[model samples]
Target: MDLKPLLNKLEHYRSEKPNKVFTMYLNTDPADPDQQGGKWRLQLKNGLNNFESYLQEDGDSDEKRNYWAVKEKVENFMNENEMNLKKSVIIFATGDDDVWFADILQMPVKTAFFWEEEPVLDQLKEMQETFPKTGIILTQKDQIKYIDADLGTVNETNVYELDLDTEDWRLHQGTHKADSNLGSGGGKTSKKDEFYERFEANRYRWYKSIAPKLDKAAKNHGWERIYLVGESDEVNDLESHMNKTIEDKINKNLLDHEETKVLEEVL
Candidate 1:
């Protein structure tokens, strides 16, 4: 998920009263031993109670009422998304609903709570740093797949296949039609060899043709880092053609792997 707009909003937030914003980061990972019996529920309950009890003792009536309103909202959100919980949940809200942000993230987070004048964004900023907006280009032969990701999750995917007829790449959709020109039987091997030889001869030029397209994609999608994954020669040739600085290159063909597994292997 993109955090630029959200971070900008939170950074500029201003509440009429002190401690008006409520921020929460809860770890609800089921695999964690500390969370084995749905322990996050208990933690949530206790955390909310602690804030309410403290407000009851020292806060004015308005403060107490606002806290209660935010508390109820947070509880309702958790209840609605309880079944769909990921590794963690984050929220930032106010009594008047002037600012409300909530997300269930695939990555884990440290559990914490805060009632302050502005949103708590330390953890969020750290996550953004660790997993910034990235573009993963998986290239193999005449095909390329682009994976756009942010904050450790996939946002969009696109595939491009080279059109030998035009010597240019085109965005591919649905089932790709098989090549009808590859000779059958004994001539199949010869046709395949000839095709490979032609591709090898024009490899640099073909990659150069699409370099600008990839650069545009990175700019349009706000990719902070680029990764090229494929054979060493292909990756090196593609990197040489592109103007964007590649964060890294993996000499492994992962174009046909599952998205999740590819992420695990690359990131």
Candidate 2:
């Protein structure tokens, strides 16, 4: 889900013929943390050994040297960043002109090897399709934060913001002057009620302004779920104006928070 950059790198590698390239796979389950030499480490060694043997069988001395060099690089990489057992790993490494490019994917993949230009991306593509994206929308007053999330990996795809106070509502004296005049006439309503009434009206306008844009964005990105966060009353106010399709995707528990704080609490 957060693999956009990785995919772009692979696309650029399609035409590259490096000194050597290897696609390595390991079933990381039953993890070997710190890579303190455990089952995963053993699997890593075996996978590389098998790949080297395959390359050496019909390869020249130069090919053999490139294979070992890449092997050493991969070993060093694993040492630096230990593999997680919960997710499978598929690594792609290629070296040319003393420069190397490696793409590592930690996801569920069938344990196999592919010595090719790019790592096989079929599993990732499938996962993306299976798990439609998620959106987190936080609406309050004149500010709204819209975030796109990739729930499969708990990644934030994109974030956007909208502010609707081009002309400050607080600077408007007419409404307040009207309130003062009403008070002089012995109006029974509390000052709090008048302020709240104005606030609610603004809420309606803000909600109406953002609903169509949010709906279009959700549909365009094929979002399967949405996390609406705000006071329950305001959440209802905004959602009331949203397209029904978007409304249907809301979670049972509409989250509560002001802005980005909900990101920490929800996901």
Candidate 3:
């Protein structure tokens, strides 16, 4: 896509909301791209202020530390911006329970897509029941397709689906193409690579079909800024992988826009 125009538009918007704060979700999974090599820590070290840490001696301590560290950074950012406690957007990954906590705290909540798992669907259904007004965004193609099928209709009035490529925003660079990497198992040597290759390919296809819907949802929400906390590259490597930049995409796609700040760990 031609990104220069979008970049310029985002720059204009940034000039207007110099203090706006946006948040991104991070997948707390230790092996998630956002958590590898403690990259999220480095990204948040000096930026967050209000956060809670999980203290555990088991192998799960790392996970707890990561979650608390991010919470602290986000709290700090919110304080610094003096975000309207009621209007601030809190972005969460698919698996974080904190998403629900943020809502209880009275902060506005937004989420990325959760796929076909019945467990996740049940969780989503519960969340929707609790926060009927909350904004839940979807970017996975398969999830969108399933939702559309189940709903038996396409409603652009409230939800959004964008036409961008999910791979560009989700997968690590170069992992999408076919090669020997396609089926070589990374673990347990029995067709592992092949399994991952197929998995990656399927994910890529699904994302492509869903990006447009996500774009529409983001635009419809008229969010002033976006905050993300997740393991996916769309929430992690957004600045580098997507040529237009997050700030720009917000300007082009979101409403009442100003700036986009991502508080996330390096994936």
Who wins the lDDT comparison? 1
What value does the lDDT take at residue 248 in candidate 1? 98
Off by over 4 Å in 3: 1-195, 232-267
**lDDT (Cα, 0-100) at 119 in candidate 2:** 61
TM-score of each: 0.87, 0.55, 0.22
* Local distance difference test, each candidate: 0.87, 0.56, 0.31
Residue 204 CA displacement from its true place in model 1, Å:
1.7
Candidate 1 matches the true fold with a TM-score of: 0.87
TM-score of 3: 0.22
Which ranges in model 2 have alpha carbons more than 4 Å from their true place? Answer: 1-20, 25-38, 83-86, 97-107, 131-134, 138-145, 154-203, 210-248, 254-267
- C-alpha RMSD (angstroms) for model 3: 21.0
The TM-score-based order of candidates, best leading, equals 1, 2, 3
lDDT of 2: 0.56
Report the C-alpha displacement of residue 53, candidate 1, in angstroms.
2.1
